[model samples]
Target: MIISSIGLSGYYVNRLVQNSEEIVKDNYRTLLYIEQMQEDLDEIIFNINNKNKTLEALQDYESVLKKQEANITENGEATLTEQLRVGYTKIKAHLEESNADANLIFKDIYSTKKYLNKIFNLNQIAVKDRNERAKKAADDAVLYSSLFALTAILVTLFYIFKIPEYLVKPIKGISKQFQEISERNYNVSLDESRNDEFKEMALSFNKMTKRLQKFEQSNLAQLMIERNRLNAVVEQFDIPILGFSEKNQILFANDRMLEVLQVKKENIIGKNINEIVSNNDLLNLLLNQENSNNERQLLRIIVENKERLFSKRIMTTDTEISNSDSLAHDSIIILDDVTDFIQKDVRKTQFMATLSHELKTPVAAIEMSTDLLTSIKVGKLNDEQKEYVDKINDQTRHIRRMINEVLDLSKIESGIIDFELENTEVNLLIEEALQTVQPFLKNKNIRISTEIQEQLPIVKVDNHKVLWTINNFLTNAIRYTPDKGKIDLSASLKDGEIHIEVTDHGQGIDKENQKRIFEKYVRLNKNEKGGTGLGLAISKEFIEAMDGKIGVHSEIGKGSTFWIKLKTNITS
Candidate 1:
């Protein structure tokens, strides 16, 4: 600041000096020219009638006056100098003629001298005025420079003293308190008198410390109560629960878990899970450090000589080692016993068989009745009578179909569905599916096209179930498609699999309904004449059971393309 002030003040001083020197030098030169002009006038007076000497002196005098006129410094000096030039011109007029009257010449010279004297005095006053202004400017420059220096000094000294006290000391106090907080010490204070941001911060810090102190004082008992409550709640859960540290130590074992272990919950706490569980495979799987939080798998544990299925739900916490006081456990292991579910599934399958047998007798009787009515064994029936018989037969068949579908659903869920796999030619399977659905297509006037890739590899699948799935897709396509619409059946060897696609230009399913279309009993727009919505679900089951994939690509108002891909038999 001092240096800058000095530089700026020196800049003003230098500008003033330059301007003042120019004015003073010009004024001095003008004065010298005026004095010389006066001397030349006197010489010219003596040299009158000496034509050469008189003319030379007259020229030199004119030159000096012109020079002095150009250098006029003050406001009034210009007029005074111009009047002197007029007087000199009068004198020159006389000298140029060389036959000039003495009185007229002397009068002109006297007039010239008076004007010159006036001009000189004006310039001298201007010089004095300008010199005083320069001095004043110099004094003002010094005063301002001193003032700026003093202000800078005061600011520097204030910062030097006040920074350490008001800024640095408070900051240091806060920092030291924070350091103490890092060491788990919350008993610290800071100055709170200063009205600044730091004061607010200090107050906040002190409040935080007070809160932390209060928390530290009361935290343990409250935490113990909450922990006990949480433990009790978890213990009351029917499902087993366990918590493990990163070191695989059992931090918590609930009552259900203790029952599974055949030990007291308190006895298992703090013991490693490896020490409690005898199965090394299951223990190693749960204690595997590489297991990520998203990982979950089925595990079996033997209790009282019987094996129980547990869904090993492993959950990892976002606990950082740097935060030693974090409340989060390393990992939480929730063991949900799915043994009852498995048994129930078996019971469900057995119930399906029982229900199917009971319904089969009634269904068979109705079917037999419909057959006899349609036949001529009962009586010769007219056209309307035969139509009623046929309708009754269709209704009976539909009921039977629904019952069969229900059984199939149960069987699929219970994993009891049998599949006869074989290496079947792709084109033959597609041909049989198309042939079965041809009569339905003719009813709607829907055209069929095929694009079977030549020399396609044979796939290993259940031919009946797989063909039934294909026929299901084609039937749906034929039913929903408008009359005269075209359906294309294409089979190809793609990505090392035999892909069969049934594409048709029909009123496509909406996006929201497409995902759930394959689920059990989910139908889109019941207004359309479609089956019980179990066809696609059964189709998905059959295709998946044969290790094939089934899906549909559809857009509303465009069309739908249903596709299936079956794995080809890998040749050794």
Candidate 2:
């Protein structure tokens, strides 16, 4: 824009100079015409003063005067033209007078010529001023062009010399250093001696490099610790540990794993899992790579020379296992020795079966005695005998409830019970669970309050399973709460989640026992509680199968709260 303005101003100055020159030329031409007219008038007067001149001389002078007058009229820039006309009029008047009169008029003509000279000088001065202005405008245009050229050169120099060296070079150097680190070259470092931000950045980079090295070392240390823990756990237990790959390679084997496979550790390490074991079915499944995200099945198998049945759990962490072009790093198969757990389970099942069988005899005998005494078959019973029979009946009833609770616990621990899921109102479940424990609340003289959100949506869950979990919470609350204590049941919807909470003013669980409360056969305080210790364990399994979570909050000697969270609108 500045360049264009300078060009435009230069063009305008040139136009003004041209117009002024034309005016000067017109003024000079008009001055010449006035001079000619003045000369003609003088000649005509000269002829009249000589009185002896011929008529032809007078006629020639008159014709010359007429031609000059025509020229003066055509050129209007002549300032002397008006004076020339006045001089001509005076000369004509003096032509009939004496020669002395003509001389005076001629003096007036000279004076007009002097006035015309001043006008011509003024025109020349105006032309000189305009020329000077145009010259200054040209000089300014040259200066503006030089300045713009200089600015452009400086800008280009900045881009070439300053930006590349200071900004681009540093950025590229940092990028190269990162690329080297990504390729696992941890030795690379940014140069920081410039004493600028790059230097500070380099210092930070060195600090981060050291931190990464430390983290890598720490991660290795943790892996060693975890490996040792795993080894220790394997040694302490009789379970076998086996490692396998997709190509049927038996990559690893613990001492027990080798013993169970009836081979040495060295022999088992390089052998195919299928060759070392009796089952090739697991090999087929591992070979058939399908969806990566799906978990592989745990297969139970009987290996050669090992009477105990073993299960193989296959696991892979491939994101594209089903893709033909995808390459898997490894597949791990953990061989767990379920011999002891299975034996213990079998013994437990047998004991419960035997207990059930043995219980019938005693119950039948007591029942028959009571019937006989009530029928009065032998003799009329006294008040004390009747009272004893009643006590026996009450004792039988308590035993029966205890037996039923024990059997339920056994079924739960053995994973035999299946949860029947259906849509049910959580508030109604809480109310039912509360009703079951109302007698306990009354006995303990405790106050119970409930707050259920109105219009609470129904949850897809197993009614019996949810009721059992609620019963567990209330039972724990009742057992731990003191007399006249308070218990609260609350349910609400928050952040698109349904929350059910049970709170009690009881002796809260300690930190140590809180974590273990959900474990099978685990109780928080066994001395103060009487049960088979399966309530929380059963409740947890049931809730999880229905896609829910359970948690507890407790502080010693304060109180405890149990809460359950479940997803809404579950279709399956």
Candidate 3:
């Protein structure tokens, strides 16, 4: 558009310039020559009496007239010039006569001046016509240049508004497709019909999306197969297993879990567990395990018209899904069936109770019989008989103590032991326990020391049970300590709890055996002990029943510090 405007303006300007040059060269020169001829005609008429000067003026006029004749540019110009020439020749002939005729010469002079006037008027008219034509050409140049410029501007504005829309529309579509792909949706395809770079880009993008879709399908198939195999394996287990996503959505539930939940698989899988937990009490309890006090507490569930015990186990894992950099937390809740173990434990407790009860009577009778035989009123015996009676009494007393321990353990297991909770002073409790174990301490020749903290808080516990646990700790200390070994008993207020500790310098229990010392039938040193392995175990149960904690810290060759922490009366 700009080039066309420039070309159009240039053509019109060239025409106007040519028209001006023609006015200056042709019409202007003709007018100038006509003015010179008019001057010469006047001179010839004024100086007709002087022949030389008149002839000189006539020659100048004739020379100008000839130039005007050759330079005729307008219509009728040549005819006017020929008339002027003829008129001038007549005037010259009349002027050169022997007897000069002034009247005839003057007549020719007037006619030539008339002819010069006509030529001058014609050239002047031609100059005016050429000027008007040049003005029109200039107007046409301006009008056409402006038209072409306006057209160029309109075309430029059209492209300025429309080009971006044409370019950005497809790019916007492709960008939207990319966004969809980021969200794992590969269903979008761009228009490839465009005949540009965008078309090649679209084709390549479409090919990539197709490959990703196919790869995703293949991976999904493999994942589904693996998932099915895993589910099958989980279902084969006797334990109930349930799985959940980070959003509490149930991902999978084994057949055993579904059976225990008493719901169909379709009802729970892929659904939010929170939604199902509202109507299911057992499920609600299970889900609340994350915040429950006793996470490993056995659940007594009734299944198949019989009571079963299940212990819960929760396992969490971080999993990465395809096309994602973040991790998704998954939880697996497994319920292990311990019904048989619990039933067997109950049966064992029953057996121990019965056996201990039956053995208690025979053991008591023999202890009484030995006491009687040792009495002065019953009989006097030799050293050998005395030694024999003393051995029997000692053996019976140990058997009686073992039986009593067994009986206490059985009662504790059955939850039959009645607790007499009372606020007891720490000093008084330690003193009483020391008195009870004084005979053992004396027999073993063990030294005893007490370090009771002043102003210790009283503990709320079963006084007899606490005393018995302390006595057990003291007896064990005396048994383990060598002859003349020192035993330290201490009580203090610690962290709102009354800490009663017994430190014995003896063949100390090893680190490995310290943990199991409080478990039933776990005798740390088989060759050193003479009583049943139920003392520490019974002590643990007794202290725990009173809402206290018991533990031992020991090292080889050093002493063991057996301690129990009971909450103070105020704290309790």
Top TM-score: which candidate number?
3
TM-score of 1: 0.55
Cα RMSDs, all models? 22.7, 26.3, 34.5
Runs in model 3 deviating more than 4 A are 1-173, 193-197, 290-295, 318-328, 569-572
Q: Candidate 1: where are CA atoms >4 Å away?
A: 1-225, 245-249, 266-268, 271-312, 316-329, 337-345, 376-378, 526-530, 570-572
In model 3, which residue pairs have backbone atoms overlapping below 3 Å? none
What's model 2's lDDT at 113?
Answer: 60
Question: Compared with the true structure, what per-residue lDDT tens digits does model 2 show for residues 192-225?
Answer: 6777668888989888877777777887898789
Model 3, span 311-342: residue lDDT tens: 88888999887667999999999999999999
Tens-place lDDT per residue, model 1, 188-263, is 8787897877877877878888899888879778868877887878878888777888776877778777676567
* Model 2 regions lying over 4 Å from their true place: 1-299, 305-308, 311-336, 357-397, 413-415, 495-497, 570-572
Clash number for model 3?
0
**TM-score for each predicted model, relative to the true structure:** 0.55, 0.45, 0.66
lDDT of 2 at 313: 61
